[model samples]
Target: MKRNEGSFEFVVGLNRYWLKWFGLWPHCDRFSSHRLFVTLLMAISLLIPMTACLFESNDFADHIEILSKLIPIIMVTIKLFILRVKRNYLRLLVEEVARDWKNFGQLELYEKDVMMRYAKLGRLINIICIVFLFLVQLGRLDMRFEQSEEIGYSAYQALWYDLSPGTARFFIILILRSRKPFNITAGKFYIMSMSSFMNILKTSGAYLSVLKAIK
Candidate 1:
């Protein structure tokens, strides 16, 4: 059923008034399509270490691994929430910028700035992932050297090596898509960015614990 615009506006104003009184107004909108994509990417990244837990038969180890995965998952979820909030903020920002949009050059300049920022971020993530992959491959080589006398690295080890880089790449894409801040970082408490290496580390640690248990 179609509702009257006047009624709809009245309801919105009422809600806004209440929300403001409750200190809940102006909440960010983090549920946009871009944010959803980022969340999925982060999830896939966390799944990398999960493959290690698969080889273990010990329930206790599996449980620990499960616990480890929780942190990154939660962090990613929070990031999604923040992204939603940021989207709401963007609406306000666009409104502010719109008045200045009368000049075609200014609008084009803003678009150019946005594209440049994203492009740079993309390059940075690609470089980081490349480095991460190289290190992982080196570790795999070392693992194989030790296992040469045996089966030449167990299936679990091989899978971990394979999956980790892919997971890292997924995170890179996630960061790219999420519009997460790259330059700015905080102490251990937070990355000061939507998605972060710290989050990946926390999640990877949990999965690693699980893998260690299996081993």
Candidate 2:
């Protein structure tokens, strides 16, 4: 019994030592930030079902289905945001260290930089998951719009009439997901796509200018 008590005391002491030195207390102030994220994620999840129920018509069923998918998406978005925040914090920490102790050499800086990069990668993964889900929702919207117009209705109608709040929620989910790079290749591709689009616009503008000058 005495030996067991001693072991328990040793464990408790070890925990105290680590908590004090590592600043790893369970109820620490830093946990408040994590808690806020959890709250927001839960709120988004709750909103999914509540918002879906509001759409009573069959036309809005697809919207609700897409909105339902957004619960997982918003949760993933919060995770991505948290990782981005961590990366930014690490960056700020490195900057602050550089300002305070110019002697804080590359080793310490590199360590933080590596951590920031890894956090960013995690954020990117979450973003990819979100984007994949968003694209799926978009495909659904496109199909819905196409079906509406195919049966003899207007095309490219006002979003107010064509898209419901549920659909809006799905679009928001897509935006959240697309806010990061899913992988190195995907990131590169996204950058290339943006560059290509810009180049196309520039060429188009130049062509228009030449035509105007000729006229």
lDDT of 1 by residue, 1-215 (tens): 12223322332444445334333345424443554565566676666566455445478877676766566566755665574556567457544433333332434666746644654565566667767865665554555444443332233234443567767465445435434222323565643322445567699999999999999
Cα lDDT tens digits for candidate 2, 1-215: 45434433333344334333333333336654565556566767776675666564366777677677666667755665564456556456545533433332334768646645654565566667666865665565555544543432222222534688787676555545544423213455532233444576799999999999999
Model 2 clashes, total count:
0
lDDT of 2: 0.52
Deviating ranges (above 4 Å) for candidate 2 = 1-113, 153-215
lDDT of each: 0.51, 0.52
